[model samples]
Target chain A: MTPPILELSGLTKSYTAGGAAVAHVVGGVSLKVGRGETYGLVGESGSGKSTIGRLSLRLVEADAGTIRFGGIDLRALSGRELKRLRRRMQIIFQDPFSSLDPRVRIGTALAEPIRLHRLRRGAEVDQRVEELLATVGLSPAHRHRYPHEFSGGPRQRIAIARALAVEPELIVCDEAVSALDVSIQAQILNLLEDLQRDLGVSYLFISHDLGVVRHMAARIGVLYAGRLVEEGPAETIFADPRHPYTRMLLAAAPRLFAGPGAAPRTEIAGAPPSPFDLPPGCAFASRCPFAEARCRTEAPGPDSYRDAGRRAACWRSAELPPQAAEESTARMSPAFRRRLDLLHTARREALA
Target chain B: MSETPPAQDADTSAPVLSIRDLTVRFGQAAPVLDGIDLDIGRGELLCVVGESGSGKSVTALAAMGLLPPAAQISATRMMLGDKAGDVDLAGLGERQLERLRGNRMAMVFQEPMTSLNPVMTIGRQIAEPLIRHHGLDAGEARTRALEMLRQVHVPAPEQRYAQYPHQLSGGLRQRVMIAMALVCRPALLIADEPTTALDVTIQSQILRLIDELRAELDTAVMFITHDLAVVSEIADRVAVIYAGRIVEEGRRAQIFEDPQHPYTLSLFASMPRLVAEDVSGGGRLAPIGGQVPAPGNMPAGCRFAPRCPFAVTRCMAEVPPLAAPAGSAGDGHRVACWRAPLEETLG
Candidate 1:
């Protein structure tokens, strides 16, 4: 197996608002992304998934822990070294509208990165910009157009092109497709997948939508209140989630279509606990249906299930049933199941 | 609960709201919404599903007579209540429309933060409608406002009453918005993406609250949303809108089980399913290529023809009327597509 292109360990970050600790936004998040692999980080708002993304690129400094790139410790790097390293690590933000300068032409935006990195010179810069545009499925002629001239989907393509300009090995996608329409979102997701294959670029994909993450990522990490509650292969995590919080998330997510005999969606009884005054225990304990006395008073460390290559941080992980298996099957319609089978066999044949 | 009528009987009764050939155009540009037709029965939840430029919100606004003065709205028949006792919303004066707006019908917008007034207390905001419509005194309205808050399941109603909109969480703010909209018990409620801004857990809670409230009040709901999953959950009837037109409308079961329109079929295909078996292949999503045409550059024929996978020469030359298929159950299932029942043509 190839070594991980990016690795973060024991990462912790906090913020103070009005001279008071608001919350530890990212509390001891650790994960690895191998070369050409997609590592998905899923959580709701304030789960610090975005902060993790920012911290990996050192766009936001962590209060503690280490970030390593290509087996080199990034935290110890000086200003010059960090700047040089940033070219190989890029971030694509959620809102494409605000990310790109409205006044700048698309060509200028793409060329600026290549020029700044000294990757191309003179006429070669324009040629490189056009190549980047074509790579993201946009026309070279669109280079002259302003950001406002393009729609949300194409604007996101432009953002991808800009990220690709620096020839980054590890790109962090922070809710990149959340703002797009479903049809448009599918287009972008397919584009990202195609690029991943052709370019062999690894991704740290962060989103609140588990379905999208499951589709894109090989490995998945479920975050709650700035902590990793579960981590496993995407299939194992989706099929048989161990943590109660992960199960609740899967049950709460609305299905694409209601089957003839689907069960009613499970409702999480209470709102998430405030990050500011989180109790000294499981952050999700208050909302967990199976929370016991131990769950309320003691925080559990990661418990590895060696055979499944899965881990869950819950006191009751051993006792918990595999809730996702039955629910996933019952939620899918027969027609969808048939089409999915056809798609799989067709894909496998093409790959072979 | 006994006072509430049966859902089946109510479905057979005259529609609570009916619209025919409703068109809206701003200035001389192409119509934002053209020849739109819909009928929502009493206590039915009709989901208007579409993407951004599909004019779902415009339909809601036109129904409420809340369109800007410059925008032109025309409808052959826009009636509220049954035919015998119908109220012509199109012909009503501004003064009369204002009276019916919040009393007989109410709207809940997508963002509760902006929809609610920041300075005013939540109780006062909720009580405004009760006092205006029911002729209740301030003291009576305040008491009733607390009851409304409780009905929407806002925790600690008394304490929340004094809090400003800024002080409440997103979920709490939305509950307050629901309380304000339903305080008067309107016969028709138009919710424009009420849970779009909320998290999944909060969104489900709000959806359940809306479903329960609609059942108890027996109020017809016109739910506008871009999320197909939300539509699957809350809608009794589904209307698939595309490029300012209702391409298909049918019962939830019919729409999901046997979709007719190409656009609707593509929408279903585009969504990433959450099942585990499907995730192994890492196949590409089925994307409908191209964008929703700008209002000014809309096609003369079928608006969806450009992006439709089943498009033929005729599909780009003429628009199809909304009609039932040749062989189907006599449910009011309708589709406006030249090549509908796509099984025959595409196969």
Candidate 2:
């Protein structure tokens, strides 16, 4: 698969805060993004999802392991080589408003990246800036507007445009649509999807929102306390998830719209444990309902689950009690239910 | 269908709180809440869903008579229970509103960290509401505060009562806020995004706690939120607000199943689906272009016309009256649109 456009092997990052000893935020996360494949890295807040994103881009130095992009070890690259490598990889931050300098206009923000990468100058730079703006669905006239003048959705579009200016092969979109409204999120998701199809750009999409991840990403990697607990195809993970944590996440996520008899979500009672003080065995063992004696003493390595392509780090992957398969229907607002039902009926007829 | 137990279906004649055409304005500028109307039936939770600057907070603030001095509020009709009659909240004096704020209507703000006093013990903060609103003695208030904390599912209530805001986590602080807001057993409670800052798990717990407490106290609730999912879970009726106006309002089922407004449809379409794909070919998510206009800079005709896909000349040139969309069960369903294609749009 083109040697995986971007690959990370046993990446680890830690921090020493407030005179305390070392705390490993990202213990050892290993995943790969194949050429033109969207790899979703899912985790909760403080789960090292953002840290891994930053580490991949070398925005934050990793304490251990390798980051390989396009057959080059990013960790081993030096000076000009590292900087040159960065031009091909970009990151779209969570908070769009704060990511771009408030003092700079949209056009200027787009221009800086192109200029820094030495991709274009003069007339070429202007044309590239306009192209980037239009690529993200923003009008060229919006170039003069400051960050504050734009809405959250437009600001995010601007950020995406800025990311695309350098024509990066791999873009790390970290919670890109988390702050946006649902309608705006759909627009951005569609934009990103369209861009990927057109540009053949690979993405390491990091987010806490699994539903969004499921829709946009082909392969999914579930992260917990800086460790990759599950990595598999999106369809496999969603339809028949093996990891207990993965199952819990899928259940907790809010469905778009469902009928009256839709199943109630299986809620995980407590929050994820602190990374600094994670338990010795499985990091998720504390919150996992099926935790056993074995789980408390030994962490499970990635093992084949439903297929060879799908792997989950769990002791009870194969022999767990069956989770009651709840009716997986969209939860419609009462007003939308009638419309949704009609639409469903029409769709069925058309399919027949 | 699995019906709720018989015990859960008790009916009452009087709504706990009723508001009509509640308008709050700062000077001559367009009303922040223009002709906003709402009702909270006894023991029912009504969630007001809207984006930022949709006047959700303004509506809550006005209900508590907490508007700034320069602000003007007016309502054709406003009532709290049968006894209070139709007292104009806009005209109510500072002294009367102050007495009613905690005693009859209490509010839980979004951020518990900033809302709770850092210097005071969590116990005292909760107790203060009881002591002032109900005129309870200090000792009794302290006892009641501990009870309230325990009721809100705060473990080791006694120890937590003495701890300051800094010592407790976000979830704990929110519990403390709930305890303080419900200390007086107000007839109506206004929770303004109480769980927005908490994690999803914690958010669910908080919602469950609110539901349980509301049932126990029989207090009507005005829940303000931006998350449609949360509203679907908790709201008995949903109000879709855009630009300080209720574009669509209906029962939870109607709101979800028969959304007529383009904005409402977009909200549902935008929601990330959590199911396996089927013959439906995945419902094409229609994102409404453009931003929600600023309060003062509202459009000439319909507020949502600019962003709506079905916007016609009439929609842009003149304001559309709030009318019932076709195929609605009854009059309760309302939408403000000039040319809402009720049949095609619903599909």
Candidate 3:
């Protein structure tokens, strides 16, 4: 098997609060993304998913962890070496509006990275910018326009183009398409997938929306209060979520289409505990329905489930039944089903 | 507490709020909301679903008489029903509307932090409506405010009542907003993307709370949102607005089961499916081709034609009126399109 493109071990980060106590934001998170593989990290706000993403790129330094890219320890590298390594890993933020400079022209923003990396020089830089724009489905003519001139979808395309300009092997997309409308979100997701397939770029896709992560990621990790509760193949995790928190998240997400007489969605009982005041045991113990006395007293480490590749941080994962697949069945009303089927068929025909 | 009769049972025939030929425009620009006709029955949750520039929020604001002074609002009939009777909200004076705003009708905005008064305690904010509208004393209003907070299921109602908006979490702040909006038990409630800013778990809980309150108090709700999944969960009826016009309006079941308008169908197709396999096989999401036209530069005919897959030359030349499709379930199901059923037209 080919080596993983990026790997981290025992990553931990904390910030001092007030004058004395420390707030653990990312605690002992370790994961890997293979070449051209998307590793999705999903959790509620303050789950430390974003912190982990930033830590991998050294945007936020880890208190204790070993981050390796292509078998080189990032922390051990000198400033010069790390600067060169940055060209291989870039990040696309959630808000395209704020991520790009308001005054900079779209072409200049795309060209700046190319020039910084010395990827191109002189007249070739403008040509490269136009090519990047076209790669992301924007016209070459759009290069002259400013960031504010484009809409949300186009602006996001520009951001993606800028990220691609550096030709990074790994791009950390933190809620990359969450701000756009649903239709526009689909376009951006498709563009990301196409870029990954064509350019062979791995993504550390971090988002709060599980549905989108499931669509874009090959492997998934469920984070709760700065800790990874589950990690496995996206298909396996969605099919048989062992951790109670994973199950609750899957159930909590609203389905695009529900059956004519589907049951009401189940919601997790309470908000996530603050990272500043985490419990001694499982971070999700307060809200876990199946939590036992031991769960509140002792934290559970990642344990292998039925599958060797699947791991969950729940003592009862071995005993828990597989999730009911009823949620996946296309359970639209007959009339609605017929209409959607027709629409899908028509769409496929048009695309073909 | 006075034994108030069930609000839903009072008038089954008359709608809680009704509007016809409603139009709104800013300064000299094109109209943002054009000829929007809507009706919300007592206790009914009518979700106005649309994209950002589709005028869903504008409709809600216009109905509440909350549009800015520079904006022009005109409607043939804009009636709002409450305990007193039906009042013409469109023609009412600012002073009269001020009396009706928080008394007969109330609104919950997308951001609770911005809507809430930062300096004021939650108790004072909630009690303001009860005291000013219902003529309750401050002490009595405070007691009722605490009860309202408890009803919204805010933990530690006593403590939360005295705390300011900044002290509460997003979910809790939204609950306070809900409690405040319902304190007066206004016949109408306009919630503009109330849960869009919240997480899924919190969003579902808030949705459940709103559903329960709607049933318990029988309040007519105008829920404006861009999410179809949310609309499916909460709406009894849905109106799909596109470029300042309602392209389709129908019962929730009817609309979801058999969406007639191309824009509605496109939205459903564009949404990422929960199941990975469903999304994986498709090469690209079947997104509508173009962006929604800006208000000032709207097309002469169908506003959605530029992005419509089934658009014809006729579609670009003439605007379609909202009418019942030929073989749809009932008059309640209406579509504004040159091509009513896409399957037939596209084929």
Best by DockQ: 3
What does candidate 1's lDDT look like per residue over B1-347, in tens digits? 11233244556777888999999999888999999999888888899999998999999999999998998999999999833277999999899998887788899999998889999999999999888888999999999999999999998999999999999999899999989988988889999999888888788789889988998888899999988888777788899999899999888777777677778867766776633344533446766778898889998889998876556799888989889965777678898988766554545
lDDT of every predicted structure (CA atoms):
0.85, 0.78, 0.85
TM-score of each: 0.95, 0.91, 0.96
Candidate 2 lDDT, tens digit per residue, A46-146? 77899999999899999999999988999998878889888899898889876799999889989998998889979999998888888988788989989
Estimate, for each residue in B1-347, the C-alpha lDDT of model 2 and write its tens digit. Answer: 12222121465565767788888778777778888878777777888988878888988888888878887778887777733554555567899888788778889988988778889999999999787877899999999999999899899999988899999878878998998889888888999999877756577678878878887887888999988777766777788898888988877666766677767766665666622342243544445566778656878888888776556688888977777876555657788876554455433
Q: Over the stretch A77-128, how does candidate 1's per-residue lDDT look in tens digits?
A: 9989999999999999999876799999999999998999999999999999
**Model 1 residue pairs with clashes:** none
Worst window of 10 by summed lDDT in candidate 1 chain A:
A339-348
Point out the worst 10-residue segment of candidate 2 chain B by lDDT.
B1-10
Candidate 3, residue B14: lDDT: 85
Sort all candidates by TM-score, best to worst: 3, 1, 2
* Candidate 2: residue A283 Cα off by (Å): 2.2
Candidate 3 recovers a fraction of native contacts equal to 0.45
Model 1 CAPRI rating = acceptable
Quick one: how many clashes does candidate 2 have? 29
DockQ of 2: 0.41
